[model samples]
Target: MWFSVAIRVGLAVLVNQKRYQEWTHDKLKRFLENGIMPNLYYAIDFTLDEAVLDVILIQGVVQCPKTMELYTGPTYIPNNVREMTLPGSPSGRARPIMLITTVMRYHLPSDLDWFHQPLTHYDYRKQRATSLAVAHPS
Candidate 1:
């Protein structure tokens, strides 16, 4: 049997006049209307033996331990989008948090019986992190 774990990509956006939720909503609307996926890139480039299958969006409430403030917003999955609505923060101090989780198909050797590995243990982590700023700092 093969097993794979979903990878979560966290987006921390500061709230402004234009909320991040609007961007997500518009992006999803465009995908629904035209059936075109936006150009996607990993924060770091990587090659994978496994494949991502789908995505699910979630709006969850995260309560602060001290203030008990709640933060909630829509999240995303890979190829598919499902959403759950949760109430916003009472203090209205919770920033909208969007998390993208990639559903994946794993290819594990049948003889191995069990497998244990960290996502960062992969070869991609060894690759140097590069950016356009670094290329032309001037």
Candidate 2:
């Protein structure tokens, strides 16, 4: 079976905004000192193995005790627009929460046994509905 896990990254906006501004200002200042406007944006790539993924998943999400539902929402991509939510604390205080999420696609092979059988029909709609129900419980 193929499964997709969503990973969400959280960041504090208001508190970090000043730091970001200062960093940007410093970068711009350096550019000005060099007598040139910086052509912004740089790309970097890194690879991870299964062990790394497992560690991250374990650290990031809170597992549901009864259902064992793994909720790993978005993960931040260095420079990308992300969704923000207001999370309420135990004290009923709300704070801004920024999240960038991505779905991790993987597969689980089934054993060739009587208990494990493939679906007779490939009904994507039915599968999607089931997945949605599982993801969002009433």
Candidate 3:
């Protein structure tokens, strides 16, 4: 018998909006099931973050937590988007949180500490943080 633990990929979005953005879980579920990519926010050379979300969405299938196919572990996308209804609006947006728990070897991050930081009201501050590290684990 082949004994092995299974791994799976999970995607969860946590949004922080300037104003309350409206979107039901069903809507998001549908989009996710269909691999619909949101207008996520990220600066240049931040493909690591974007890639994690993209791969999970593109795969559009949950992988087991121990599945070898998934080298990257589960990714958790914490609330990041701000101010914008699902239908329209959005000067900017946040990255969709995803988990790749299938492959522990990869360790695809789900909840980076920065995810806890609130969005800045100031344009300059927000701009600077766009590419810089906002949180560090102690």
Every candidate's lDDT: 0.28, 0.25, 0.29
Give the per-residue lDDT digits (tens) of candidate 3, residues 1-138.
000111113223212222213655565444344332222333211233332333332121122222223212233322232121221122343333232222123332333333444565433325435465568789
List the candidates ranked by TM-score, beginning with the highest: 3, 1, 2
Worst 10-residue lDDT window for candidate 3 reads 1-10
Clashes of each: 3, 9, 28
Give each model a TM-score. Answer: 0.18, 0.14, 0.21
> Which regions of candidate 1 deviate over 4 angstroms?
1-58, 74-138
Give me the overall lDDT of model 2: 0.25
Question: Per-residue lDDT for 110 in model 1?
Answer: 36
Q: Model 1: how far is 50 from its true place, Å?
A: 30
lDDT agreement of model 3 with the native: 0.29
Distance from true position, residue 130, model 3, in Å? 43
